[model samples]
Target chain A: MKTAKISNPSIVLQLDGLTKKIGGKAIVDGLSFDIAKGEVVGLLGPNGAGKTTTMRMIVGLIGMTSGDVRICGQSVRTNFEQAISHVGGIIENPEFYPYMTGYDNLMQYKRMTAGVTEARIAEVTRLVGMQDALGKRVKAYSLGMRQRLGIAQALLHEPKLLILDEPTNGLDPAGIREMREYLKQIAEAEGIAILVSSHLLSEIELMCSRIVVIQEGKLVTIRSLGESETPTQKLLSISLQVGNAERAQELINLMEDITIARADALTNRITLQLRQDQIPGLVGKLSTAGVEIYRIEEVRETLEEEFMKLTGGNRIA
Target chain B: MRNFTGLLVNEWLKLSKKRSFFVAYAILAVVFGILAYAFYELSPDGLNSTVDFATGTIMLQAAGQLVPVLAVLAAAGSVTQEHRYGTIKFLLIRAQSRNKILASKYIISVVYTLTLVLTAAVLAVVAGYIVYGGGAGESTWSDFLTNIASLAVYSIVFVTMTFMIGILTKSNGASIGVGIFSMMVGSLLVMLLSRYTITKYLLFSNTDLSVYNGEGPPIEGMTMAFSIVILLVYMALFLSVSFAVFKKRDIA
Candidate 1:
């Protein structure tokens, strides 16, 4: 609905020590992160881990107790209208006037957003594949239809930053996939920075290029899914087929920080977990001990396993 | 200023399409229609009533009753319904300031009340013509205008209080409860306290400006100018609190 020339083109949103306190207790504590253009970042936490609170602060639904959220280089506290003009978001569930038609609901938002043309309304509805349902009242819409309409309105403004809390809350597998595709497509084609939060680890793994994990209202870790390495995430899975699987595993027992994930006697195969930098040493020691190494390949750990390790097995709801 | 008008248009469209609001207007229409029939059938030859029957019916019908209830429902919905449907999350996040949004809702609620009044005024005139046969009891347009102006002042006073309740309670049931309770008991309190000096300063006692031109003040000393100042003071108090709280409070 509004456009401003970004002085900082790369970073669309910046959270500097964002914190929110209620009743003398902190709900979100010292959280900091940055989202760049054409990037999809996920906020992963337990059910009450302040993910929703952080999203609210960014979109100005909830006032921050201390710290600030800067969107497109404008401070939310000092310049709210200019800062929020570049954002489009749905905090939890996308709610609208149920008695009104979907088209009328969209028109309500359109009228408040300056410079939005009627043609853009058509374009957004088409983009969400909701042209047929536009005439029907919103009460008749299924949850999935409302989610799509939510996305349509968020994109109607052509915002520089998009924030969604649990974007795939009630969608079926296929619908979730469709939402992911739409988000990725919008991010790439329109240069929009997107932030989606969910408690489902595997869901975040499949959708986001990077994830910011928070537990107990504090930053735990930030990891990139794009082949970037961090010390805490250096664990790797190695599968090797040798002449004697048991003997090869026994030989690697002397190596520190090495453990067997699985072993097969019939096929002479052993699956080992170790650090990425220690792979060559493990293979060298196994081959020098009169063992024939037929094949070795690295297997990536499932993101669920990594998330569990990072969050320390907090119940994700 | 343009942004404020745009918000007003949005509120008007939403309220007009609302079933509850539309039903309120429908009831108003039916009530006026029935009252016209009753006035005609009960009197055989024309009563030749001196009062402007059209204007009198509007004030007597709406003084502290239907108009206030309808206006309160509409006003309360501006806050409570938004929270109920979870639409306030989206509304509060817009580029417009919360002050502007609150101001728009205030004006729209008043506009809604005035529109209801205008409809009843028109219907009352028709009823006046049909029952009186346009011979004697028919009011001059100026008298009709004066009565409408008086009703407008009363509407402002009632609506300001109702909207302030909406802001304070932030719950549909609670706002309606307080609005109804106050309007219902306002006159009773005034009557009971009429013997005391403090009754002259009571809000309800000063609200009925029609006392100046018609029945005179129930309290001995209240004048038209004094009532205007009192109304302005209360409006300022209610509106300042609304803007201050709305601008700073968390929407979550």
Candidate 2:
């Protein structure tokens, strides 16, 4: 996969060596990342892994103990009003005046973002599929509807940088898919930089072009889709035509190049990862020994597996 | 300055959206209406006590006074409500300076207090005038209205003071409880102390609007000019303390 070089291209948001300490503990430790225009970056971390903290700093919600945040190359601490003018966000859960109609809530947000017009409000409501419920009070809406309205509110000004923290949280599978697709469309079509943080690995894999994984308040790895080669490991599923599955599996387990595990043997299949060279050797050895060779296929590690490996299986439920 | 005005409009809209505002208005209307009727029944004559009855009832009935308490309640919970609802982070993240946000809320809380208090005052005056056959083409009520304006400033001052305390405490229960208790209980405590000693500075000692009536010795050895200065100094102290504390608090 090819990678784009940084050549002074416009950066909509950047966090340089950001750190925050709360209750004498480091919540965000020397975190750094950047989002250029038209880029969608996923922030992946455990439940307590500082993704929210980083998002807060970028939006100027929480002042960093050290380091700096720049929106559209403007320092938040120095030119807060100017910097924040280009950014829009929804942190954690989107709260509204529960007694007011959804339209009134949107109007309130529009009032916050300068130059927001009724046409723009209508456009955003349509974008988030909330046009029909605009007249209903927010208290009457479901969580999914409220989340969509939150996104609509965030997009009211067509912000240059959009930050959403765990946006798909509490959404059903369909809602999650809808949110991911909507976010990708806006980021790509509108040339808006998006930074979304989530605990769901598969959701990030599906939406983001580049993924930043943070663990225990430190960045572990930054992976771009199809850029870095997945660790040179593949799961192989081998099946035998004859009903000598137990004996064959035992013999294969003795091999040094692979770790064989017993798979449900309705078809007498064994699953394991083997070296590329070991595959040719094993096939020859099996044929020569008169073992039935039904099929040999490699299963690539999914983003979920890679996430487990990168996070060392420290995910929270 | 335009940005500040825009923010003020937003804050005013938020205040109007709250149920407490309407509740406060309803209670004020009912209480003032009842007091208007009672004043007419107890006036010196059947139909000749228009201006006097209006002025007497406004002073006698605590009905309209609830506006200030409601104003304090509104100010007490305004910012703290955002903190509890986890929207302070969202609010602070917007393209507004911290001072602008504080100032907007401070101004809006005062405006809210003034609007409610003025409504109550109008109702009391109108009801009294109607029940007692109206003030007989006199300039006395006009001068009294001017006096009411000065008293209105005091109500505004108390509302702003309560707002600052609310922001400083960042807890609705604590701010509201302390604000009301200080207004009510602190006045009682000061009055008690004044009976035994030389210090006679009670909170309500300054709240009496008729001090300019030239009736009794001033409550705290404070002249009108000195009293206004003390109120200004008190406002500055509370506002500065609120800003200092809020600037240090961690956004939720």
DockQ score of each predicted structure, in the order shown: 0.66, 0.59
Query: Which residue runs does candidate 1 get wrong by more than 4 Å?
Result: A1-8, A228-235, A239-269, A273-299, A315-317, B44-51, B61-64, B138-141
Top DockQ prediction, candidate number: 1
Which one is best on TM-score? 1
**TM-score for each of the candidates:** 0.88, 0.86
**How does model 2 do on interface RMSD, in angstroms?**
1.7
lDDT of 2: 0.75
- Interface RMSD, one decimal, each candidate: 1.0, 1.7
Stretches of model 2 off by over 4 angstroms after superposition: A1-7, A226-267, A272-297, A315-317, B44-48, B135-139, B195-209, B214-220
Alpha carbon lDDT at B215, candidate 2: 59
With candidate 1 superimposed using the best TM-score fit, by how many Å does residue A60's alpha carbon deviate from the native? Answer: 0.8
TM-score of predicted structure 2: 0.86
